[model samples]
Target: MNLAFIQNMGGGGIVTILLFSLAYFILWVYCLVDALRSNFKDPNMKLIWVIILLFAHGLGPITYLILGKNSKTTN
Candidate 1:
């Protein structure tokens, strides 16, 4: 609420922020690797999706997870 109250929390806020940032970075990296590893019938489509995911950051990754091609084999 107040600046003094925030200051009283000392390094706790900084630690929390650092932890969240690290987690985000890890998730971003995981998404990148997953994008690379995915198998799509169209290589260009796969590349486009990877580019979207890499450039759009959080939103792109969520979209890829929700709407990108699935790699399951079809009979």
Candidate 2:
């Protein structure tokens, strides 16, 4: 197949990439929502975590799930 045809059809790589993006988006949204709903020990930290999740893209949610959880639980 031609390059143009493959591009137009969204070949295997494209499909995989799209699926990965969708998964990442879902995970990010889940993290954002969780961060919003959760209570933090510091009181002010909930807003900070939400901002981090908003800007950090790949790492923000993961960080919240990890270190942020500990901080919040300590309260």
- On TM-score, the candidate that comes out on top is 2
Give the C-alpha miss distance for residue 60 in model 1, angstroms: 1.9
Q: How many backbone clashes does candidate 2 have?
A: 0
Candidate 2 lDDT score at position 67: 84
Q: Write the per-residue lDDT of candidate 2 for residues 1-75, one digit (tens) a residue.
A: 556756676578788889999998998999888888887878888889888999899799778778886866633
Give the range where candidate 1 is weakest over 10 consecutive residues by summed lDDT.
66-75
- Model 2 worst lDDT window (10 residues): 1-10
List residue ranges in candidate 1 displaced over 4 A: 1-9, 69-75
Per-prediction TM-score to the true structure, in the order listed? 0.67, 0.79
Please state the error at residue 42 of candidate 1 in Å. 2.7
**Relative to the unseen true structure, what is the C-alpha lDDT of residue 25 in candidate 1, on a scale of 0 to 100?**
82
Each prediction's total of clashing residue pairs, residues at least 3 apart in sequence or on different chains, is 0, 0
